[model samples]
Target: MKARLPFIFIIITMMLNSIGIGLILPVMPSLITELTGGSISSAALWGGVLATTYAVMQFFMGPTLGNLSDRYGRRPILLISLVAMGLDYILLSLAGTIWWLFAGRVIAGITGATFSTASAYIADISAPEKRAANFGLIGAAFGVGFIIGPAIGGFLGEIGPRVPFMAAAVVALGNATLGYFVLPETLPQSKRRTFDWTRANPLGALMSIRKIPNLTGLVVVFLIFTISHQVYPSVWSYYTIERFDFTPKMIGASLGAFGFFMAIIQGGVIRMIIPKLGEMRTAMWGMGLNFVVFILVAFLGEVWMLFALMPLMTLGAIAGPALQGIMSKLVDDDAQGELQGIFASVTGIALILSPITMTSIFKYFTDSDAPYYLPGAPFLASSLLEISAMALLFVIAKRIWGTAATPAQ
Candidate 1:
């Protein structure tokens, strides 16, 4: 229990960090639109801009940070991320221009790979068998933060967009100060890997994937699942506004429900469920269920429908840690940093692509009353992609892990 203290602290800090981000997310589009004197479409475009900008920066910096963490130890890296994040939030609160928002997001994205480093930190301390559960706990922290953060962000957004940003800034700053003392270094000098640019660069992670047997298959499965998953963030804000005629606060509240449902499934349920179900089987179940939910979301008209389907969305989140665990099991601890960095980059690629795809579709089809008429095509397409991803996962499992591998033991 004493040894687990650092993991607890690190996970808590992560929760706080995500909560800060989540709190601002729901209201951001509307706030930016108003601030920029742009159309709602323009607002939605900026939302993608902010996210893609962040993801692009993350795509570039994730491996670098992870590699550096391996050499310098996780404590300093973690602290630096927290401090930089807090400053990012502060800058967000002060932004009076659209460019300011863009700059803030760029900083936040570059520094936000704190989670990747956190993964490396968790790996540093835990045994192989325990890594899945610990990583699951990290996933749970994100779910909990998203659950609570949106509610706070929604409530505060009614006062002003800047108000929520200020609040997020304060929370981030406070977490950094507490984390300095509470979070200890997990990677000792004896275990540190030498940073190799060939293995740690943005292209290097993908290029290196082919050299490792079975890893390419796993990465392929991972990439497909992530691309479908990226759709929600890339388009949901615009979806809610156009479909339900929701205001910023209302959007925040709806997203809050989404986060709450995620917390229930991934945070509370995964711990109990994973030990019984096994990771691969559990992930397949999650993907199949997500496919069903997203298909329904495509056509559903009522705001109440989103509430009803939130649980389904939550169920889909189970794939993440399950896959993360699989990746951890397949690789050695020394390479966990590089492997997770590659994982971050693949997801970043999805983040990069999902926006341009979804928003273009939305803009082409969306009408003032389209939500009542046809809100299902994008979601339906997303569902098909999910189903395809599940098929790929199974094919990968059989081809790589062999027919002897079963999702559930």
Candidate 2:
């Protein structure tokens, strides 16, 4: 039990971090709408811009933060990010204009890159054999946080749109305080490397992934998969509101359900399935499941259908931990932070592009004078993207690892 304390603390930290972000999900579109004088179309556009700004900052800074953690320590970087995130939430809570909200998201993005550092921290502590299960802890934390966050945010949103932001700020600050006292440094000084700016750029970081043996193709597959997954975060709130007229509370409830399902699958089902199917097969199956689910989401006529389908969607959670487990074994201990940072940078790039694409499709199709109305267009696009990712994964697996490779234990 004593040996597990640090891992427990790390899980708590992840949960708090996700909760702070998730708390705003149910309220964010409404907040933007209220700020923009109640225009849903305008809110969708600005929401995309806000999300784009956040992703833009993360794209540039994620690798840098990862490198910094490699040089200094994960504890400091993680603490600093938590504190900064708290402050960013405060800024958002007090925002009087669209620019202020954008400013807040920019700050949040810069700090949020700590997620890569957090991943590196997990890599530091876990053996290669245990990495996938440990990595699923992060996903579990996300699931738990999302479960609670949107519910709380929806309830608090009834008081005021900005209330959830203030609550999130408090939660972030509280987590930072707890971490400062308890979170141990995972990367020791002996294993630390000096930070280099040249290698930390997004392009440079991506290039670094190519240098790793038997990893580049898989990294490409993950990037495509990440972009495809971004459709949910990019348009879920707007789509539900536009198509089903879901209230903030209803949106929160839906998100909570999604999170609950994800947590259960990532925390429980993954551990069971990965040991049997192996990481490569697990990833393929998960992506294939997601492809089918996204197509179903595009055609669903009733909101209850979403609830019924969400549990099935959670099966897709296996792909990430499975892929990460495979990559973690390919890199040396010292470069773990670098690899995680590169992954974060790839996700940042996807986030940057996805919000623009998903939100634009949503806005255009839902327009009053549009040729045809189809709010589900974004989900349809996501399905197509997932199919592409699945195909890429199949080719990479065949060409790189071959058919008889043993499962990642």
Candidate 3:
């Protein structure tokens, strides 16, 4: 039990990180609408811009922070990020204009790159055989947070749009204080390396790929998969409002449901499934699930359909941890931070493209003058992207790892 304390702290920290995001999501549309004095459609465009700004910073800074953790150890970087994240929420809570919000997102983006360091912390602690299962635990933590955050945020949003932001700030700062006392140094001095700016750029991911030749195909799969996944956070709020006329409270409830089911699938179900199916087949099956859900979401007619779809919507979460475990094996132990950083960069790239593309599609399809009004257009696009990811993943997995390699054994 004593040995499990650090893992507890780490999982709690991850949950807090996600709670910070989820706590604000239900209110973001209204907040953006408030600040910009625009229609929901226009506010969505700005929302995309805000998300893109955040992603842009993460793209540039992810590798840098990952390397910094590699050199200086994970404790300082993780603590610093948590504190900074708290401050970003504080700044956002007080924002009076769109630019202030943008400034806050910039700060949030820079600090958010620490996600790589956190993933490395998990890598540092886990046995190779259990890594994928543990990554699912991380996903479960994220899901659990989402379950609480939106419910709280939706409730608080009735008080004021900014109320959730202030609440999120408190959660973040308090978590950082707790972490300062309990979080141990996972990366030892012997494993530390000098930080090189050259290796911390686009070259970093390329350099990693150069070292692990099989990673190139996986990276391609990762990119497309991430972009497809972004459709949710990018436009879900707006889509629901336009199509179903959902209130902030309803939106929160639905999102909470999504997270609840995701927590179950990732936290408990994956442990049973992955041991039976290797990472390769687990990922393929998960993606296949996601593809079906995307298509269902694209054609959904009523709010109940969404709630009905929640189980399948989340069952696909196995793909993320499966992919993470697969890639974790491709790198040396010392380079774990770098590997997660590379994927962060890949996620950043997806974030930068997905929001703008998705929101624009949302705007265009739902506008008064649209040739054909269809609020579900973005989900259609996502389904196409997901199917593409599935096809490529199968081809690449067969070519590289064969049918029976990397059994999570």
**Candidate 2 TM-score, true structure as reference:** 0.83
TM-score, ranked from best to worst: 2, 3, 1
Best by lDDT: 3
Ranked candidates, highest lDDT first: 3, 2, 1
- Candidate 3 lDDT score relative to the true structure: 0.84
Residue 292, candidate 3: C-alpha displacement in angstroms: 3.6
Alpha-carbon lDDT, every model = 0.79, 0.83, 0.84
Write down the TM-score of every candidate.
Answer: 0.81, 0.83, 0.82
RMSD of each predicted structure: 4.2, 4.0, 4.1
Separately for all candidates shown, the number of backbone clashes (residues 3 or more apart, or on different chains) is: 3, 0, 0
Give the per-residue lDDT digits (tens) of candidate 3, residues 1-409: 7677677888998888888888888899999999989888888888899999988888888778988999999999999999999999999999999999999999998987766687788889899999887887887787788889988888888788999999999999998898888888999999999999986785455555667767887888888888888888899888888789877887788788877887788668988888788787788888888888888898899888888888987787788778887888777899887787677668778989999999998888877788988888888888888788878877876776675344463
